[model samples]
Target: MASPASQDIKSIGIWIRVSTEDQVRGESPEHHEQRARAYAELKGWHVAEVYRLDAVSGKSVMAHPIAKRMLTDIRTGAITGLVFSKLARLARNTKELLEFAEVFRACNADMISLAESIDTSTPAGRLFFTMIAAMAQWEREEIADRVKASIPIRAKLGKPIGGAAPYGYRWRDKKLEVDTEAAPVRVLAYELFAEHQRKKTVARILNERGYRTRNGASFSDGAVGRMIEDPTAKGLYRANYTTVGESGAGWQLKPEDEWIWTPVEPIVSEELWERCNGLLAARATGRRPAKKTSYLFAGFAVCECGAKMYVPARRGKYVCAACLNKIPVDDLETLYRSELADFLLSPEEMSAHHAAANEMLREKELLIDAAESELKKIVGSENELFDLYHAGALNKVDFGRRHKPLSERRAQIEDELPRLEAERDVLKIGMLSRDEVLEDAKDLSDKWPDLPWEHRRQIVETITDRIVIGKEGVEIILLQVPFGNDDELATKPLGPRFRGDERY
Candidate 1:
């Protein structure tokens, strides 16, 4: 039963979207469009236009050109009823789905999903749409988490986990197989890089010698550097090498130990890889690359004014271009390591924190049990009311009056149950292993001078958000990642990480 306005709207727009070409046997774009058309015909509505977003991933709504055009048309009220084969085809995420709903509602357009029989013209249908959209997003995130979790499992079993096969290898029969043509190029690239101690020189040599990458592209210095530095080139798998970055900063590199490593069929010997990397490291510090003084934290460090820190050739001073903030490289590294050393909780503090977590967990469990008991009591009351109504103990109006509040309370508790259960899991807190932090921090703080600049950089990158060089002093923001909350870890200390010598 449509509204008079909706029934009078004869022209309906059909939207068909599929993420990949590998759709189910009868789930092609044509099949979906046909279904929408059939549904429109049954409603006695004419087809306005078929909007097909073929082979478009629903991950991003704005990425597809047709989707943008469709939304623009929606905003302009060009279409009456906007119809889709399925909700997932409309959008993958809840926020995007809600935005679509808002746009449609604003344009006074109805949205119809044929597969789910959801018509936004009805209140219940709108509610169902929101719930389904949220459920779909949660399911997607859970599936992605499971997939990401399986990466280390795959690596442990010595399997390649969905990255491009290294330059010298190709995936064959679900394994890394040495590429005959490209293997020699990888070998030669390393040999040249080791001898020449430069990626540009190796790139030129490889190109001049008619050697190219697996993609048949001429070797660029960056490409050559990547090939030489990659552990995958020497037949090793790397997992968990990335960590969540600061807001708006993308993923950052983690410590080497955080990265899971497994062996693969060796393309080059470990000795050769070591020699090449060692030579590469020697060049990183000892030699000036492209007439620029390469600071250990060049790209990794930022200033208070939010500009990148760079080292000038003359004075070994790390200067911020925007604010002219300066700090000596040695002093900056020392202050950073000192701040990091203080990150680990003491033995007594950690013990107390663990105790608090256990108590909190127990309290949460009891609270959930109490909530569930109350919910069950309400259910029992509702059943009693229904029984009375059936037995002529109450009139229909009275029955409705008694049932509404009970139903709302039941719905509220039912909705809250999942969140409460999730909180319980989140509260299943683990003790921060001070020893783990101590070993790494101690090594970085006390033993860094003996280590190479490359090793030092790798260690520094593991926990540093960025070194903000303020006029007051250098501010070091360490990546804490507090066990229960992420925001708790984002704090900066009251004072400078440490002060440095006066600017030259």
Candidate 2:
């Protein structure tokens, strides 16, 4: 039966929904609202309000709080009719759509689908709506079948099916590739965690160094722990892990064999990745005890026994939990300083730096000479311009215009001249500071008994990369201080690489 004209809704609520993607299927929230508004306006229905579910998808319609709130509004008769651009925006599943339809009917509310021109208030319209719903559901099922068949293939081929790329990587060619800037931070984080076996400690160090995660957030203990344990770091991708929930919406993990494996460029070595995961696993079960002292090389030293070197509550002893390796703290410190104390004091070590410094010195001298020549040319040009103006060979305006820029250029060069001359022999500063550190360190020997423990420790730590006390005696990996050819070592930035038992 046809409804009375008086039963026609005079006012309606405008509902717009957007997917998590900014735009899905080329449909934007604004475009959907504009189209719905035009249709409602054609029937002379006033838009009482607009409700948007923006950037929110993936949740079931029942679980969407906003959707529930809308239901409450409809029941209370806030608007004559609830209108959306399409039925799919209301609910993806036909079952949920029917539930929503029943709610509208019970509320004595009219629902209008702008795209289908279906008004549930009319018998004929309701019948058409049901038929459309059935067909749409069938179409959705067919689409799902196609997606299910293809998505796994994409995953197995090492392609990112969708969503954001993992940390230390960016999406390129539909695959995850190492992000140059973030990859180092990720690798360094793994190294730090492997050595200290503490996520909180590693997080603190990374945060202090101004490193942030992929989301531009500071690392937390839990976040760092999850990152290290993630297999994606080692380029072994896992896919098909999540499947559609059996009951309805959302996803659940599939059986292990269903997981997809993909290969990508690894940021950290396999051993480094394994060590961190092992430590994370161990810490999950039982964390190791905290050290009682913060010695000079506290967390910076490693033992060949595969455990971090720890100084007991007593200051002069180092012990490794993994093996019977033990060392007198004094003997270890003495050996480290003797072999790799100050690179500046060693003629062989400083030779490269000295050569680089001399080259820089010569370059600066040539720059100064070039600057003087340029300055003299500018002055001569200015003088010639003035003589030409006096002889009327040039106009005053032209002379002023040309002279002003040259004068500014001359002033700029003049300003830069002193800074150029004052450029310190870069090599000398690098060498002297190093020599001073060693000389200061030498004073910390037993002969200088007045030195405070804290001071002595700081001096030693400032120059050392890490002190590895192993069966191969004491190996001290000093900072690779190169005055000249500095970029050579700097180019290949590494956190720490472990080759078999080698510790750095």
Candidate 3:
């Protein structure tokens, strides 16, 4: 150098920051601050003050109040130099760091980072700052890339991410759960929409009832409409989409058919859910689009002559396409109900089979109870170990070695719990078979003739399957397990029976 730099030129201020409370408890920020003070003292510089910002992110300069004051001091000539632990500690955002560097230049002040050996007073130091800024930008981009790549992978696995949980859900243990508090609001919204079929009316009802969002804000019509359409109320998750444009961002609703169904506990019965969808569709299309005719049995109905029985008209008229043999729609309806009743219950040996199914369910309940008890024992052991470590009875190394295996066991138990619970739900559902099948059978009998041909086809498909029309007669297949396997219920047909070549 032409001359040695003046040792007592100006006062230097130390800038120290700890990003989180955990980091504050650790030796990081304090150690960096100590090293920075030592470095300043070794250079024979006067230390003006040390400004510490705790739990502040480096991404935004505006968030740190103490850092802002230090910038003011440097600009007013109260400090000629600012020292920090590293470039990242100074600022992680490139634009803000460069902007502050310009301000430092204007005040004739110096910037020093002890860890990075960066001194912005010299040309070489300024080049190093530029390189640091470029690296910070690269780091940020890499982080964003990782996040983008992980989103779809997590979503497909039924993991919750991105925005807040839908109206009826709460985020718990990194998953979405039914929020007891908000569930009633969701039910009310659906009920209102079902009754009025008007978004404005639903919003008015909610607001009048003092129903508000999580933050206590009053509901808008658009908000109420969204709540009605969200699949989470039916225990499914749907991804919403957005597009960037000149106006800013545009959002669009995805159709229900395109949504992903993540099987959680159903809050509404399938029948009720279907009814609501039918009502919504009716309102949307202005007129009821003739009901969907593709039943579970539509394609499966084959004549004895190896031809399909096609329902070609609006009445319950079905004919064998190949042989031209026809049967009244009411007759086919009766044959299907009779077949289902027979499949569900054999009147000859009812008590034996009913006892068997009940016994099977009781055994399943016992297995579920045993599994749950085992899970509790494993959880209890983990809690004890955690308490020991907290009370200083165990060291970190010992706690970690024991805790890792316990956590693995607990995870296995958690995985098995859902399957066990599902089995229990199914058994409970099976116990209510009589009322369900009889009610459905009676309802179909009453509505069959009155319903349009297309609606009749839909109802038949909803409950029955595999109708084979033959030279001998028509054969009907029930879709699910018949409700009365214990008795010969099929012999007593619920509706009108069909004979060969019968006409309505």
Clashes of each: 0, 0, 17
Tens digits of lDDT, candidate 2, 1-504: 112122222456878887866475655576567656655543335676677888766245655667755655554344547778667787777656765775565444568775554555433345554665466446546644655578788889987576567778888876678899888888888989878878899999999999888778999998888688777787555555777997877987675435555556778765567556545544554533211225656655668665676665664667776785667766655555445434434566556544554666566668778987998899899999999999999998999998999999988886665445333222222234344555554434444346566555545434444566666565565533434443222111112322222321
Assess every candidate by TM-score: 0.33, 0.27, 0.29
Best by TM-score: 1
The TM-score that candidate 1 achieves is 0.33
Q: Model 1 over residues 1-504: C-alpha lDDT tens digits?
A: 122222223456888887664374335576566556655543335566678877777876754667766655554334556778678889877656765775565444568775565665433345555664566446545645665678688889997575677788777764567888788889888888767877999999988988877777899999998888887766565556877888858888785435555445677865577556655654654522111114666655667787777776687877876777788877776666566555443455335444555565566678779888998899899999999999999999999998999999988876665445444433331112222334455445566568786456545433344667776676665433233533122233423445434642
In model 2, residue pairs whose N, Cα or C atoms come closer than 3 Å (at least 3 residues apart or on different chains), thus clashing, are none
Task: Indicate whether candidate 2 or candidate 3 has the larger TM-score.
Answer: 3
How would you encode candidate 3's per-residue C-alpha lDDT over 11-123 as one tens digit per residue? 67888766886485653665566556655543334677788877878877644567766766654445667888677887888656765675565455678765454655433
- The window of 10 residues in a row where model 1 has the poorest summed lDDT is 426-435
Q: Give residue 292's error in model 3 in angstroms.
A: 9.9
Whole-model Cα lDDT of every candidate shown, in order: 0.62, 0.61, 0.59
User: Looking at model 3, how many pairs of residues clash?
Assistant: 17
* Candidate 2: regions farther than 4 A off: 1-160, 243-252, 287-504
Query: What is the alpha-carbon RMSD of candidate 1 to the true structure?
Result: 21.8
